[model samples]
Target: MASANVVDNSDHSRFDLLVDDKPAGLVAYSRRGDNIELVHTEVDPAYEGHGYGSLLARSALDAARAEGLRVWPLCPFIQSFLKQHPEYLDLVPQTQVTRFKLA
Candidate 1:
């Protein structure tokens, strides 16, 4: 099986997951100063249930961690993912958690 690849298409404010070099899913976000607010996530219907959304979410979050940027997971999928994976909580500012309703 071909491994999927993830790329931040920042010009379009999204991160894409590619399978065989084709877009399989994307996680959209908006930049806010030194932070990013995850706005949405979508996987091509054809790729649904293939874990593309989760892959995209993980990649987007990993990128945020690598860049020393905080994430506000406004997207429900991201929020749910974070809820299940509390290890990523440190990448989100404690103060904004309440504001974003993440707490």
Candidate 2:
């Protein structure tokens, strides 16, 4: 099994995914009041098809939950992830539910 880890690099406003201690992917975000706006997601081509994107998304969303913050998925990857993972639907504010089509 590959050794993988996710870390929140607040200084850079992104959650990084490391595999075998090497950078594999990242989820960029911006904090807005009580919400976190997911801006972009990128996984190295070498790491593609390894589920690193999903891992990054989950880690970012999990962090938001722990911090009691909502999510605004501006990134297409995050938006698709949210649609497939309804368990995280609560993280999106009610006001943005329709806008992001989370509901």
Candidate 3:
């Protein structure tokens, strides 16, 4: 069965975006005591602008939601993704929004 939860590739400290079972991109993060700091997100140049980055963003956020962790999106890409998708605004604590410029 296809799992609802995204895989956490801890060895690499990132979530993999797979295409045909191969990684097309990754969303990297660092752990912070029940919170996650999104550090970098990248898709292969061949996969750029193909919504793969969005897939990585959504998967990372959804995983954070499922794990009851808050988010600190430091990466510009992730920050922009959150801006485009306000539904995830709540994942970041209200007080820290301006600090991250996510407000």
Best by TM-score: 2
lDDT on C-alpha atoms for all candidate structures: 0.87, 0.92, 0.83
Model 3: which ten-residue window has the lowest total lDDT? 1-10
Worst 10 residues of 2 by lDDT: 94-103
Candidate 1 versus truth, CA RMSD in Å, comes to 1.6
Return the TM-score for each candidate structure.
0.90, 0.95, 0.87
> Which lDDT tens digits does candidate 3 get at residues 5-69?
24689788899877667667788899879999899998888667667788889999999998999
For candidate 1, lDDT tens digit of each residue in 53-95?
8888889999999998999888989988887777888898887
lDDT per residue as tens, model 2, 1-103:
8898999999999999999999999999999899899999999999899899999999999999999999999998998999899999899987777887875
Preferred candidate (TM-score higher): 1 or 2:
2
RMSD of candidates 1 onward, in order: 1.6, 0.9, 3.3
Native-to-model Cα distance after best TM-score fit, residue 10 in candidate 3, in Å: 1.8
Q: Which of the two, 1 or 3, has more TM-score?
A: 1
Clashing pairs in 1: none
